[model samples]
Target: MSVEIRRVQSKKEKKSFIKFAWKVYRKDSELKKYWVPPVVADYMKTLDKEKYPLYDHADIALFTAWKNGRIAGTIAAVENRRHNEIHKDKTGFWGFFECINDQDVANALFDSASQWLKAKGLDAMRGPVSPSMNDQCGMLVKGFDSSPVFLMLYNPPYYNNLVTNAGHKIGQELLAWYIDQDLIDIKRLSRIAQHVMKREQLSIRTINMKDFDNEAAKIRDIYNRSWEKNWGFVPMTDKEFDFMAKSMKQVAKEHFIYFVEDKEGRPIGFSLTLPDMNIPLKHVNGNPFTPWGLLKFWWYGRNISAFRTIVMGVLPEYRNKGIDSILNAQISEYGGKHGLYSSEMSWVLKSNEAMSKLAKVIGGIPYKEYVIYEKEL
Candidate 1:
């Protein structure tokens, strides 16, 4: 039967559009063990006209693919003004994509997304990027062994072939590393960090929750400035930064957020790590409101054995100063003392050699990879 492509319209259609992935991966034994069903509420936030401030700066369309009256795939196309404004390019993004290993369905989803973006007057379409790369972007190309970390993506290996066959070429790659306890040499790290800190007047400290607003403002400055030259770079608006801060506060561990300040007390670098909540969320099987599910979530929070480093940045002036190593040492020390057995530093741009080298220096081994694909519209 031919595949049917349709834009999501009604509330009922939206629900099925978001839930299609669960049905596609449900019976796969490999995914069944670790899949934390994607949260419907979270997906809703992306489409909420008022909640997502990004809507003010971008155009988006959500589509689902149907075969034999069943949803076989889904995708979203986004045109981010901030991204285009910063990069000075008319590139649109497509994300939230999924499908069974069916070429016709994949082609239908891609064609719909491409046509949607083309109608928006975009010059090129690149994805699978969320409204922003800061959100979950890229299709999983490697590492199928475990569940994805919180806010990370997971997909079957066949996704790569499906995307490539649909006239998409590799746009970029993101790397995820597994940091096991045995790989880290604490003694060497401490000695190296101590020497580096003493010689360079480097100081690392946890973010001050009491001054969170002020601290976040500083982080925004560094983040926008540090990555200003990156490909597809976009300066997140103040509203967006505040929105992120509010969300992070709910699950953020203070000690896991560290900043490096110079002798003059200017914030030069920062790192933010999040507990691997998926370890516990998986037990809930994607239902958080159920009584037993809530209990399991709380229990898992207390017993989490791993964390994911979500953000790490340094000002342009501080690059190559070994500041990252010092900050990482502090983070590792805190994690070790607090029962964290492993950490994942992830989504590093494949072309970012400096950061990639730093990951290796910290005993991180590349285990998972995600790719962004693009085609001229």
Candidate 2:
């Protein structure tokens, strides 16, 4: 069967592009078990060129593949000038990718993305980045037994084969580690944390929600500086940082966020965790506005017992000083008192030995793996 790839133009076409993911996942009951529907309205905003911060420095083209008049796949080809400027590489990105288990359809989608990117003078293409690294940006290659935690992604196992057959290579591997709160030795962790703090002359404090903007500013600074050395790191501008911070604030728990400070009270590192809202989000089925959606959200929201450590960073100078251990101990300590009984420290690059070690130190079991693929355009 021939697959026809067309650039999405009209608002109706864009809606179809977003809704196509439901069709893809729901086609199989087993695949639906682990898939959480992202809020449709949120994606609508992202599709709007004027509303999304990424558009300020990026160009994106959405495309859909049709087979026998039905949508078979969707993809977005992106040229992020900001990423290129920082990384000094002529790389384009493909994201918001979803397709049926058809290599021809997947290949057509990839061809559309590659042609669009190549037309713009980009030399390479890399992603699955539903937009950017700051967001969900990987293809799940392992651990398909359960649902992904909050902000993570789940996909059909055949996605790996589809990408590889499309001529993409594994550019990087991302790992997710599961930590059992019940198994944590709080006393031992606290002892090590205390020693690290005393030896480093550092103090830990919770984010002050009352001073939300100011706190976010401090965190944005630490975030850019701390993660700058990581592979594929793209510095978030103040506008982009503020945009993300606004969304996160709605779901953020003050106590679940922490900052490490020096004796002088200057912040050096931070950790941000949120309740595994995917648990309830799954119940809402992607829309939390409808009457049924609201009821489901409210009921399931109360039972959320897991947390996902979304981002944790320590300044380069302070990394080996054990600030990460202090932050981890605090999470296990406070989370136990509250209702969070388990956590996932995720997307740690396979090459990041320090973080991988920290996850294991906290008794984290490596569970899920995701891959970012690349192709020479």
Candidate 3:
């Protein structure tokens, strides 16, 4: 029997595309435990052209593979004009991928997305990024024993075979490191941090919620400047940055968000960590707006003990100056004081030697690994 690929054309089809994940996970009891149900309303925003700013600068097509009168897999093909303009590479991306344990279904889904990209004159297809690198990206190739932290991607272990069998090669590997509170020598860390801060004439401060717009702009500037040379990094537009800032602020802890500055008061770097909302989100079961869902959310939310350090960066001029140490030490002190001892430092690129080394120095163990795949179209 041949697999039929159909372009999603209606709201019903879109709903099916998103709901297919439940079916895929239902068959794999082990994988289901680690899967977090994304709030349905929030996930739908990605599909709304007017709602998601990415649609303004990208061309995206959603497709579903059908066999035996049922949906077997789904994929979204994206041609991000902004990414191509910045990188000068004609690359497309496939994301929102979900498939059962059928290679033929996966192949059909990949082939359909590839053809869509090829039609747009793209030279290569790379990703599992829902839209781009700044958002949810990567496929879980390792560490399936625990649930993912907030904003990270996860898939069944077999996803590796499904992708490679469909002709995609590993393009890059991203890491998630876990630092246990007990392993950290806080006193030593503070001593080193103080010495570095004094020598560098740097000061650290928490984010000022009252002056959020101004603070967010500063962080965005540091983020864009610091990550400009990184692999797969595309400068975030003001709107996109603002959108992300708003989402993160909902769960952000003032104590965990820090800005590093020179004595002259010019911001040089920042770190943004949030309590792991996924812990409560898993309890909501994808609907957080309903009365029952809201009640369940509040009940589970109070016990959120996990944290994910989502973004941290330093300006190029500030690098190699131990600014990172100051940031790490501050996070540790604050987290310990608040009874949030451990956290996940995630999605660090394999090519980012400085950050990876810093994580290891702080007793961070590389527990989970994710990979992005690529193939010539």
Candidate 4:
């Protein structure tokens, strides 16, 4: 039977696209315990053009692959004008990709998106980024033995085969490192932390909950500018970044959030690590509207035993100035003292050699890997 690819035109088709991952994960027994289901409402918000600020600069189309009238796979094709303007490349992105093992189904889904991009004058296609590089991206090709941390991507091991068979090759590889509390060198952390602060005239503090809106604005200034040179980078508009800050605040932990400022008291660098809320979220099965599920989430938020490092960076001028080490040390010491057992420092790009080497030097094990696939359209 041939797979039929069609544009997602109706609300019912869109619903199927959002919920298709649940079907895929449930069908695989191996993923039962390891997969953490995202809140359905969040997915809906991201897909909503009126809500997701990225749509302000880019155009997107959603497609679904149907076989015998059942949803077989889904993908979103995007043409981000801002990304091309900054990078000087005519490229499109295919993301929110979910598919079964069938090569025909995968090819049909890929072609559906590829053709859309090609029509837009994009010469090369890349991604698994729903809308842009700032959001959840990449396909899991390694580390099926554990659950993903924070907003990282996860898929069955066979996803690699699907993308490869569809004529896509690796565009870039990203990694996640597992760090155990027992291996954290607190004394070393404290020593370097103090010395760096003194030498660089820097002061460290957590986000003031009362002043988070202002703090987030400051971080955005650094975040957008610092990462401008990164591959696939796209600066998030203020509204987009503010929306993300609002979301993170819901589960933000004080100790796990650190911001560094110069002696003159201007923001310069920051690091954010959230509790591994997925540990309890896996039990929700993607349904968070229930009273029991909401209660369970609150309980896990307080008793989380590990953290997932989400974002960390220093201003370009502050780079290689020991700010990175200070942030890493502060995170490790705080987690260790708070009874946390482990953390996943993840999605570090393969091209980021400094961070990759820093992870290893700090007793991190490269436990997982992910990649974005690319092909000329």
In the order shown, what is each candidate's alpha-carbon RMSD? 1.4, 0.9, 1.0, 1.3
Residue 27 in model 1: shift from native, Å?
Answer: 1.8
lDDT on C-alpha atoms for all candidate structures: 0.85, 0.91, 0.90, 0.86
Q: Candidates ranked by lDDT, best first?
A: 2, 3, 4, 1
Candidate 4: clashing pairs of residues = none
Score candidate 2 by TM-score against the native.
Answer: 0.98
Query: Which candidate do you rate higher for lDDT, 1 or 4?
Result: 4
TM-score winner between candidates 1 and 2: 2
Worst 10 residues of 4 by lDDT: 280-289
Q: Which lDDT value does model 4 have at 295?
A: 81
Candidate 3 clash pair list: none
User: Residue 83 of model 3: what lDDT?
Assistant: 92
Q: Write the per-residue lDDT of candidate 3 for residues 223-267, one digit (tens) a residue.
A: 999999989889999998999889878887788899998999989
Model 1: how far residue 177 lies from native, Å: 1.1
Off by over 4 Å in 3: none
- Over 37-131, each residue of candidate 4 has an lDDT whose tens digit, in order, gives 87777888888888888888889899988887788898999999989998999999999988877889999988989899999999999989876
Residue 352 Cα positional deviation in candidate 4, in Å, after optimal superposition: 1.4
lDDT of 1: 0.85
